[model samples]
Target: MQVCNVCREQTPKYKCPTCKIRYCSVGCYKKHKDSCLPVQPPEPSGPEVKPASSSAVCTDPWSVEDLLNEDDIIDKVPVEKLQLLGRSDQLRDLLRNPHLRQLLRSVDAADSKEDAMKAAMQEPLFVEFSDCCLNIVEDGTAPTHT
Candidate 1:
């Protein structure tokens, strides 16, 4: 699954027509247009380029899934490591993780960034996850996948 070209949050459900890259929202789309990168074509596995059969063409209207890019995870200059954290499932197995969920909920509930961030720091799971994330950085190791 591909992440948003800008925020790298949810799986992309929209594509910018100009660049044909997937972005999650109108805000992200706006942010992306100015810094769009060149498209990368799939590598050729054999000697020559081949033509697609006529059956490959579709007449159906585009849907959200049509915007799904098969590029796996994103790690580009514009996307932050903090935004990449939720996209990674390295802490999904931590029990009592609902507090982290609450932290996320509180971000929407709280009136300001300081309040939401303070609430996150108070979450046991978030604290533990932070320790793990930092440890990975300190040790120069990739985050463990579950």
Candidate 2:
């Protein structure tokens, strides 16, 4: 779990828009906002260089890879597949449901994520949401469920 950069206590619930520093609460966010500096994008090196292998180094400072272990990297989905989730109308519609969103939030905030996921799986709406994401990512198509 990622601790708040401000308090270094609780798990962070939100990220600063400018610097992308994680903060747990509104108070922490308010405290951080005053001192937050916008992160500068990295400058490209002279020539266009390509990695010899598919295992290229991740340059983004705040990438999801930063949260993952080396073993997890092996099962990580490609950016192209993840991008398909955003274009999925089925996923957008599923996300519009407050109950599904709450279930997702509960799962995210749970101390035991595995247990939380198992509980969430019992909910039909949550299952549908999971299926929609899988359909989009795996097939690169929105679910045709009616």
Candidate 3:
């Protein structure tokens, strides 16, 4: 069964034509449509202008870490590390892994945050996801630490 991309609930009823995110309900689709636009690279207008240095890189305007600073109890994971999870292809692929689905169920069922984290880290996909995030940060694309 297809999972709703909005809430991760099973059996999404519709998929967005533009971004392809599957949604379970009309409300979810409407709520998510605005932000679900694709992240396409800007097209060149005329003759392409090249940057002086190949070292220049694209980066997110805001740090995900900064967004998490307001929550303490749930923010035990450092922003630096947490920031990496959503930036990589590895984590994207891991989402479809059946083993990860089980791991996530175990994580959500854990009584404590520590226990959830421990169980999540034990899964190979989580480890790979963490590594992918680290790679993104090291690649100079993530916003600089404050």
TM-score per candidate, in order?
Answer: 0.32, 0.50, 0.34
TM-score of candidate 1 on Cα atoms, chains taken together: 0.32
- Pairs with steric clashes in candidate 3: none
- The global C-alpha lDDT for each of the candidates, from Candidate 1 onward, is 0.62, 0.77, 0.63
Which portions of model 1 show Cα errors greater than 4 Å?
1-90, 143-146
Native-to-model Cα distance after best TM-score fit, residue 86 in candidate 1, in Å:
7.5
Native-to-model Cα distance after best TM-score fit, residue 17 in candidate 1, in Å: 30
Please name the candidate that would achieve the greatest lDDT relative to the true structure: 2
After superposition, candidate 3 runs with Cα above 4 Å error: 1-87, 137-146
Query: For every candidate structure, what is the RMSD over all alpha carbons to the true structure, in angstroms?
Result: 13.7, 12.9, 15.7
lDDT of 2 by residue, 1-146 (tens): 56789999987766665687778889998898899999896898788798887766544344563355343323467789998888777888889999999999998778667699999999999999888788778786655446
Clashes of 2: 0
List, residue by residue over 1-146, the lDDT tens digit for candidate 1: 67787898878766665457777877897888789765675788889844597776553334345434345244222235444444445655553467666666776556565567776888677788778666544444446565
Q: Name the better of 1 and 2 by lDDT.
A: 2
lDDT of 3: 0.63
What pairs collide in candidate 2? none
